[model samples]
Target: MKIVELKNISKRFGTILANDDITLSIEQNKIHCIIGENGAGKSTLMKILFGIYKQDQGEIYIRGERVNFRNSHDAINLKIGMLHQHFMLIEDFTILENVILGAELSKGYKLDFEKSRVTITELIRKYDLDLNPDELVYKLSISEKQKVELLKLLYRNSEILILDEPTAVLTPIELKGFFKILNNFKAEGKTIILITHKLNEVKEISDKVSVLRKGKLVYETDKEKIDISELSRLIIGDIEDIPVRNKIDNGQALFKDYITVKNLSLIENGIIKLNNLNFALKKHSVFGICGVEGNGQNELIEVLIGLNKKFKGEIYPEKLVPAIVPDDRTKKGMIGEMSISENYFLREKNLRFAFKNILKNIELKFIKRFDISVPYSGCKVKYLSGGNQQKAIVAREIMLNHNILIFSHPTRGVDLRARDIIHNEIISERNKGKAIILISSDLDELLSLSDELAIIYKGTFLKVFLFSELKEKLESDRTSLLENIGELMMGVVK
Candidate 1:
């Protein structure tokens, strides 16, 4: 059954046509994906469907019945729910309160808490979501917070769920578990509309894929026709091969360690966060760390960046100048209220003389080099979308030319085209003799860029191999390395 359908949807902002006569269909109980480069009308079209944005011209149908939505509440009342890329829960509220804030049960105008609590508890247990109803949202992990969002949708009894970048914050293992939940939803005949940049997930889970390019529907196909290369080409029209790191000139050249950790460990809340971690990276290569989240990746990055000093063992070059693209860019990477130029010139001592001129120079240089589309350089960063904000941050950090770059989930929430651009820049940095430590759950990305690969499990390095040593073996059988590395992450050393 065609559960949802859009006919000739068109939207405009100022003189910009965000969506140009777009049309698509989403089937009943199927995982339908909408993919595109940034500003390719995916979000705009979804917003129109959710009633966040009204299309200037279009017809929407639900269950073969024509309908119009004036606001999100109308869509919500129609059993539609949306999960945004950035979580939308208030940190100060408890899980139950957050879930049932607007849709509260009442007896004689007084608040009815007991009934809602029981209902939410049942939903949590049914979904195998290990979360406490009494717990505040502030203290929960990224994965747990995401579960709360899911619970909210269930609380409202939404059958058509729209998810935006749903797995951006999840670990490799958490992602697998989440997909199982989605599968269960499918089995139960619930429809899912997923918006994601991860093409592999689209291939693995989506029943159908609809790709958009520059506000137009460029391609549409079912999973049976899914191809990674074809999907990439459809998303961006073209793409380059995965980057292979270049080995240094001298065969016997001493690759000095820019950052070295020996027997590093951290105990938090009577739990060993990291257990005797050890790794070394040369000055001119990318060292990729592949691990399930919460296995001490954050602590290790903290140690390297000097954010957390209470740990056992040594991180040499104690005073480190590291440029980091953090996982939670909004929280840790850059200040949102600050202007792009302000973010660029922040903490610079040399710009005191002719500060305005220097700031303009920096802003113009970054905009030209990184393809940052901004109304004006003086605009605050918060107003930009997730992808644009990320690009601006990447531009600032990379342009700084720091010798050591710590890219934590470098291309987490960006589009396919943006992912390619960032990958190219990371390779460019490596070629310039700047060492990089890439921590990501994306295996293909790691394989594409790493000179050395490290598989981390349970706060320990289960295996680490230089790409050169495994080159011949990987060439003989490509799937062998993926299988071995995947098993290692699962705590099985096959």
Candidate 2:
């Protein structure tokens, strides 16, 4: 039976029509994966179903009964729950406390802790979430925190669960475990609605797949008919081929070193955030760093940029300045309310020389060259989609003409088209003799781009792999190569 049905749903934000008469049906007890590029209206459609947005023209039927939701509370009352990309958990509270915050059971006006504990513990074990109910939220890893979020929905008896980009932060090993948990949910007869752009994931776990493009439903298929190449073609519509990274033979000897670190360490609140690490950045090469988050990547970036001078280390360059594209583009990279041109020239030292016209000209140049989609000139960066917003930041930094560049998760939330564009640009810059520092949680990205790849665990580098060596091994046995890398990231293989 169809558990949810949306008919002729349409949503508009000013001149932009976010959803154009989108009609979709989600069956019961199946994983329905919605695949689309950034700003393709996948999230919008789900939000409408979750009561976070009101569709301008649509009729929603839940379990064959037409219903109207004014807010998220209404959806929750109907046993529907949404898990956003950014988790909503109280850091100071324990897992059990966070789960039962709003919906606490009562026994004669007293909160029933023992009853809730028993139920939560059983749920964790049944689903294999492996989360401790008594553990503090701040003490949990990203994967564990996600389990807590799942526990919240299951505790509410949610039959229909909607997850948005849930696997973006998971490591390879953690991702396998997460997929297994999803299968368990399916076996328990619960429906799952997953919104993501990862084609491989859609192929792996989805029973039904839907494609949206330019705010319209383009294709729908069952598992028997799913095709990854066709899905990619539908999402981005014939973009140019992605630029390839040429093999670098003896890169360390051929290129000049731009920056070097020796005995780098950082201690915060009596806990070591960065261990003794030594590395060098060379022109015409990309040094890729991969690790689970909170494993000293942020600390390393801060120290390299002179943000934290408390670290015990010796940087070769006395005054090193590099253009950086931060991981969290909304917070660290750009101001939302500011115009694109204004954010582009934010770091300029000479106000007199950085005229408005000159800045606008540079912005226009890169926008055209990079194929950034903008509605109009002088538009605020916030109005652009995630992919366009990322392209803007990347173009701005590259236009600065710096010898060294630092990119932190440059393609974190972008579409395949934008990811390809950014990868090409990075390769183009390396070919121009510019040193690049690439930090990403994605193993495929690191393997494809890095001249020298390092795995950091607990604030220290476990091992560094050369491009030629990894390429040869990957060509021989792909599975073994990934297994070795996954073990290194988790510190399982010392």
Candidate 3:
């Protein structure tokens, strides 16, 4: 049965027509994935369904009944729930309190605390969420927070669930476990609507897939009809071929010692974040680190950038200033209010020569080279699409021309076209004898770009493999190597 249906739904944000007559149907008890590039109207449509936005045209139907929701409360009352990209919870509250905040049960005007607690505990056990309801929200990790959100949906008895970027924070091992839980949800007759960018995940878990381009439904494919390569083409319309940068051998290149960290140890809140970490970078070499989120990647970056001053370590080039692009683009990379050109100027100190110029002389050059699509460089960075914001950052960082560079999740959340451009630029920089430290959760990207691959588990480097050895083993038996990596990540091979 069609559990949910949208007929000619349209939404406009000022001059931008976010959703133009989008018609879609989501069946019951199936994983329906909606795939699109950044700013391709995926979020807008989902927002409309979740009652966060009112459509200008068309109607929503649930089980053949036409309905209109004035706000998220109305949708929630109707047993529909949405898990946002960033979690919505009060840090001061416990998990149980956060889940039952708005949806509280009362007996004769008094809150039924014991009943709710017992129910929450039962639900946690039933769903296998492994969450302690008494735990403070602030103390939980990303994956734990995700489970709390899921628990909220289950507590509400929401039959239809909408998850936005659900797997973005998951490790490879955790991702498999997440999917297993989702599959269990399906077995229990709940419908799932996932909004995501990862094509490999779409192919792996989705029972049906829909492609949205320029705010219109371009294609819909069932499990039997789905094809990842064809879906990739749909996402990146009219784009040139995206070559996977797997060429590790760029001929014998002269190397110079740039940055080295010896016995790096950071103690935070009495927890050892980095356990005697040691690494060295040489010119033209790309050192890629792969690990689960919250396993000290952010701390390591901060230590290297001198944000965390107190650490037991010896850093060669102690006063090193390298080109650094942080993982969280909005939080650490750019200010939303600033124009694209102005952001560039903030990074490139040498571009501050022009106070009257909206764009730096060097910023304009790389903007065109990186293919940042915006009406003007003077436009606010926030107004530009996610891909363009990323492009702007990449262009600015590259223009700085620092010998040592650090990139964390450089291609994350960008479209395939932007991803291809960023990869090419990184390779070009490496070819020019620049040392790069790449930290990413993407295994394919790490394998493709890394001169040396390191697998980090629990704040310790489990194993480091040279590019040649890895490449040979990978080429000889790709499946075995991938399985080996997965085991290593989960501590199964430790």
Candidate No. with top lDDT:
2
At residue 223, candidate 3 shows an lDDT of: 89
**Candidate number of the best TM-score:** 2
**Residue clash pairs of candidate 2:** none
Q: Candidate 1, residues 250-294: lDDT per residue as tens digits?
A: 221367777787898888788887889887777778889998766
lDDT-better candidate, 2 vs 3: 2
Screening candidate 1 with a backbone cut-off below 3 angstroms (N, C-alpha, C), the clashing residue pairs are none
| TM-score, cand. 1 vs. native | 0.87
Q: Which residue runs does candidate 2 get wrong by more than 4 Å? A: 102-115, 239-250, 350-367, 374-379, 471-479
- Candidate 3: worst 10 consecutive residues by lDDT? 104-113
Report backbone clashes per prediction: 0, 0, 0
Residue 491 miss distance in model 3 (angstroms): 2.8
> What lDDT tens digits, residue by residue, belong to model 3 across residues 1-494?
99999999998866677789999999999999998887788878888998999999999998788989899877887778898765788889999998887776521335566887999999888778899989999878778888999998998888899998788767677788789889888988999999878888998999999999878999999988778889999988877786656554754235656788899888888988888888888788889998877778888888888889988989988887889888767768899998876777777776546475546555567666876766454677786666567777877787789988898888876777777778888988898889999998888778778887777877777787776778688789878877777777665654
Q: List model 2 lDDT by residue over 1-494, tens digit each.
A: 99999999999877778889988999999999998888788777888999999999999999999999999878888889998756789999999999988766421346788998999999999999998899999878878999999999999889999998788768777889999999999999999999876899999999999999889999999998899999999988876666665644554677667889899999999999999999888888899998987798988999999899999989989587899998767768889897777886677555446677886786688777776766567778887766678888888888787889999888876788777778888888888888899998898888778888888999989988776676687789888878788888888874
Displacement of the residue 257 alpha carbon in candidate 3, Å: 1.6
Runs of candidate 3 with Cα error greater than 4 angstroms are 105-113, 243-253, 353-357, 360-379, 382-392
Instruction: Sort every candidate by TM-score, greatest first.
Output: 2, 3, 1
